[model samples]
Target chain A: MDFLTILNNSAAEILSPSTAAFALATIGLNVHFGYSGLLNFGQAAFMAVGAYAFAIFTMQVDPTATLGWPMWLSFVVAVLVAIVAAVAFALVLGIPTLRLRGDYLAIVTIAAAEIIRFTVRTSDYSAVTGGSQGLRGQDYKGDITGLNPLTGTTYGFGPWTGTAYDTWIRILAWTLVVVALILVWLLMRSPWGRVIKGIREDEDAVRSLGKNVYSYKMQALVLGGVLGGLAGIMYVLPRAVQPDNFATAMTFYIWTALLLGGAATVFGPLLGSILFWVLLAFTGGMLSGLQQIGAFGDMSGTQAGQLRFVLVGVALMLLVIFRPQGILGNKKELSFHV
Target chain B: MSETTTDGTAPTATHPLVDGEVAPGCKKVDPIVVADGVIRQFGGLTAVDVEHVEIPRGAITALIGPNGAGKTTFFNLLTGFDRPNKGSWSFEGQSLAHVPSHKVARRGMVRTFQLTKSLGRLTVLQNMLLGARDQRGESFFAALVRPLWRAQEQSNTEKADSLLARFKLDTKREDYAASLSGGQRKLLEMARALMSDPTLVMLDEPMAGVNPALTQSLLDHVKGLKDDGMTVLFVEHDMHMVRHISDWVIVMAEGRIVAEGPPETIMQNQAVVDAYLGAHHDTDLGTLTNQQVAQIHEAAEEEVPVGLEASATETTTTDAPAEPGATAHDEEGKR
Candidate 1:
């Protein structure tokens, strides 16, 4: 077995740009479910809107199919459009569902995410969205790669080496994560943050104090959604824009990362995302090596691939059963009304 | 005391309802809160059904009744915590029928929950800070920029600190509310209510789970509210407390007002006595054995004298019932 390669791959996954993207998304989840006690299961929908909006704005396509905007302007426009789309999505979902408590929001949000995924996959909008095949990396990779200051350099030693373009994306993604963390830290310490925490504990108590509970919840939803949109943009930076990437499972994975670290804590998502990806990569490598060596009598390569997720599921269940507060969350802070 | 005012306004006469009076719908001379046809129901059960009731302005009014008498429900409806089936109530002069609980508090009428709704996860100081009115820091944009609300926050903290000292909870300022004792939580709730500077403070069972040591202090703090020219309306089951501090008493039974009078007379009223002992009224004395009869007599003798003394002292004194009560009234009158 190539144990050395496995270790290197796992290390790379931990520091990869995708890990940064997931960390940012989970941070937004922390704001929604952790601090505010809002049950938002459609984080994937926000990410999808952000990714698609950014891709569409920046892509050079037929005049009828796309905007064909300038690359730099498109980058700014894409981010703005993604945030606005997320807010619009929050309004459409939040206005009606925020009034209802708990499971209603969960059901509506999960359903909304599925709807977004399916809508993008349909042939009806294939002209702009590229349908099921989705827009490939070639569409906007040149523009994104062109912005990298390090034109022809390679970083890191041995197996850890990354192209200048990859390095640029990683820097940008991690920088976004840092910015999101600082903003969230400032927010949670403020009076507004206290109100959100109060709502999570007991909304009625907050209402009795003359603070508008609904308005606070809506603000939390929009803030979290905007962050999710940014995460979506970060996610697409290193790869192609695929509708499948924004599926319901993507949200669950983000939730898993959030819960794995610590739901309400600032550092929880960052650590959780890194650990999750690293574990997945390490397990995948070990399992594939074992299968190639005929470790299993009848289990095929595909079965081994599926078994890796099963192991992850088991790990998640154990985590919930024993340490429900997650790695960094305080047991006291986790006593939410939901 | 019964002399009518010549100013063409409602009479400010004391004890409008005579001793042992059973008024179906009592009206105050200058009512601070007026309710008409207020009814609340939970499925088939009618929780509160007040046809007409007026709470006297600037007086300590006690709403007393047996269990399930709907005292808390009435408080809920008046404070806009719960909606009434069909009713309208006004605070000061504005109608509060459709006003929300937060707006009711903003309009100078605040209430505490019977179960004590202190934000448990928050610090005592933070809880007190939350009670401050119209905080700029509470806004979304203002919260991000501390300078916008830093001065207001400092002032609010000062106010909260003073209130905490007044409530004797200054030592536990940084402690989480959940870590506090039951009685301390009650104190925290009352102290928090004062941060609003409310005109009318409605306390729901402020002494429900409190120890005797804290109960006396809570009683004094409530009396202090009246001394500061704030109208105090409280829901209480402790007859001794109701008799000791209440200027006027309104008693409810089976979701309707059965008696209204000064504290001294409310105990002697037939409607109230029946409301309390009505379940045993139909019991046959002949059916009970001699031992059981003696036990019943012993129980009555022990309880009846305290009630009698409470009523007697309350009715005879035109100034105030107890020494503390007298001083409280004087202080209020001075204010």
Candidate 2:
């Protein structure tokens, strides 16, 4: 029942790799749904591809489980494979569907995500993807942590304490987030970005202006998908590459973070992700404390966990009702009709 | 009436559609767009069926017809916005049968929407910038490196600024297009279309929903295109605007060219009047005042052909000619 411990845990969660992963994913979602008016409901699929590609590439090439490639080569190859997988996904989904408008992309993307999850979780792909048991991060965690520049054995004071390895992961995750933000900002300010925004507003008008709307849409899909892939790679660095981690609910969480921050704004996703994690941590900690003190009568830890989601849902509904444009989104730019 | 080409470029034999003897579907002296056997059908209905038609170069031409007469559909077909089932059209001697809309626009034929698609979310200036052709900044990789397209962007911005000034929308350049009034939206759309510097500018109902205050400016803009050596093809229901600015007029009725003439002769043509008034033209006279009714009857008596009234009465049960508001029905019927 120590309140200081709870406060410390929440603070630590704010800087955790999980927040970074969601932030990165949300930024990609911003490109697809916010700026381009593309409905990509399978962002989780891109993350799964990235995580599995990295895991399968780095794992030992044994009959029981992996390729066992050199750590450095596997890391680079994993990123490339993730990018290829994302582009392939975009082409397969976008080719027949970009020409048609509304809800089709949502349906296809969600179905694709579910398909990826089910395929990887099956027994057939167990050798490469580790099936439901999942790929152990302990095998390659050292490959990444070994590159840490920090000299200290344990970093940070009391409440924010973390080993140098943990610090390295946080630094790498934040670095990726910064790079993504810069890239997104630069693109949005450019003429290409202008056209993307125009497509979101009225694609026919853009087409009439001599632009290839289909090509632009494909580009957006690939770019956003690649970011989702990167997020997936970052996500598995501090945890096991479980097929369950990249679930449908992961996409919903990313979307919540995106909407909370402001869909189209550059800083919206980053801030939204941080806020989302911090709030979740704070509420969970508070609920656990209350349950320990018998304030909830007979409510167990599982019920408390369920209630945390209910509170977040209520908060999201209130935000949407009060500000449909999101925290930083312009009301004029929110043409959901498109 | 004396046969005169509005642009006064050259005098050819007078066609029957005009004061001259050029019949329907006849060639023009200096045609910019030539369509031969262009047909667009939606299900069983034929939306556009132009056997042969030529839009005169360097002059303002009007495409007028009753509601659902396929004026807009023809525009769509010619501009590559919509495909024709069976037809070939060429702009400036180049075949544009299967060309995409953007490519057609790049080849100096650009169009504006009838409903005024102003990209409500984008600022006025952004809308204008979207019109400029061959934009280097439009490339994905090039956009990342600003220096590659910065100069061109500056030039585009300058051009947009001047056009915005001309359209008197400079003050609202940063404002979202949705904030503009309906009339202002039309003006912004026209200004945006000019960014391409197209040789052929096709306007679809440019005056629809426009305020009276802006109508004169819009007319002047239409006339200015011709003065600048550009071909102007417009679809409009405002007869006065048609007669005032158009050098030549092509009239469509039931997806066919019923008449092609100068504005003066078009108003007097029996087919043109019948297309406007419909088959029950005389029966609806009760809605008119005494003087108006007298004028209509007098005109009908002078213009209605022998035994034409009997035939008109026989077909009263058929669908009436489309009115301005009936355009949606016409499009649906075509499908």
Lowest lDDT 10-residue stretch of candidate 1 chain B:
B1-10
- Cα lDDT tens digits, model 2, A186-281, are 999999999999999888888888899999999998899889988998999988989998899999989999999999899999988998998898
| TM-score against truth, every candidate | 0.84, 0.87
Query: In model 1, which residue pairs have backbone atoms overlapping below 3 Å?
Result: none
lDDT of 1 by residue, A57-116 (tens): 666442222555555555666578778888898888889988778678889999999999
What would the per-residue lDDT of candidate 2 be over residues B107-130, giving only the tens digit for each residue?
Answer: 989999999899888899999999
TM-score of 1: 0.84
Per-model chain A TM: 0.94, 0.93
**Per-structure clash totals for the candidates:** 0, 13
DockQ of 2: 0.47
Give the best candidate by DockQ. Answer: 2
Among incorrect, acceptable, medium and high, the docking class of model 2 is acceptable
